[model samples]
Target: MAEEIKVIVFGLAHEEYGIEVDKVRTIERMMPITRVPKTLAFIKGVINLRGVVLPVIDLRGRFGLPESDATDSSRIIIVAVNDLEVGFIVDSANDVIDINTDSIELPPEVVGGIKAKYLRGVAKIGGSRLLIMLNLSEVLNKNEIIQLEEQEV
Candidate 1:
């Protein structure tokens, strides 16, 4: 049998979610951000990391959840989308977990307020634990990001 795909899971507003580890580059603590006016509410702002300006988005806010102040557990999970680097802020990062394809199921008609179209699948962990696997490309599409950038300009 083929090896199960592993993903790095995290929490945002009490919900567990994950993205393929291969898609994730690194995870860092919350850094200073320069807020840009007239952008999407989910976009907290941009951060300069090692000379690279990365746009940071609050996953909770993106999912239409109440915004909260960054805490010690807050982290920015850097991911590569279409060769572009973007940072996503989460409440806390859990750990890397391997899940078999058979263990993954299609997301229900809806997830919280997010449409299932944005999800890749739902991974079942322990008995009652479920992790929503995200479709990185759909979640961070360049066109949408560019649109937000244009709004800032």
Candidate 2:
């Protein structure tokens, strides 16, 4: 039997993307983000999640996709990488599915305008569905993580 891994699937610009469930802390509805000055264009800002203030990034902007106003379906997926927790603002977070490890293939140079460097792999699921796996470490690089940490305090 092929090894199976669970993933949290989210939508961005009508495309489906996934992140390993182990890396996800929680998924929250769209919340108010307090914008900070001088941050990158994609860095939406920080949001007070429960008691912890987490930096939020607009995935659409990060991936250079067309932006849409947040609707009730919008979500913030909190993921932890290298001990830093950050929230990704997505169009919607609507599924959790398991995929066979053997089904994952190396990403092409670019997928939906996002560079392969920020992608883990691509997986085919549900017969005709394609899921793009996110490489969180690359999406939030060491330097970017440091910048996010500074946004905390």
Best by lDDT: 2
Enumerate residue pairs that collide in model 1. Answer: none
Over 4 Å off in model 1, which ranges?
144-153
Clashes of 2: 0
**Cα distance off (Å), candidate 1, residue 112:** 1.9
TM-score of each: 0.90, 0.91
* Per-residue lDDT of model 1, residues 1-153, tens digit only: 646998999998888999999899899998899998888888889999899999899988777789999999999999997887999999999899898878889999788777787799898878799899998888887687688668757
Off by over 4 Å in 2: 144-153
Candidates' C-alpha lDDT: 0.88, 0.91
lDDT measured at residue 122 in model 2 versus the true structure, 0 to 100: 94
Instruction: Compose the digit string of candidate 2's lDDT tens values, residues 1-153.
Output: 789999999999989999999999999998889998877778889999889999999989877788889999999999999988999999899889999999989999999889999999999987799999999999989776567657755
Model 2 deviation from native, Cα RMSD in Å:
3.5
TM-score of 2: 0.91
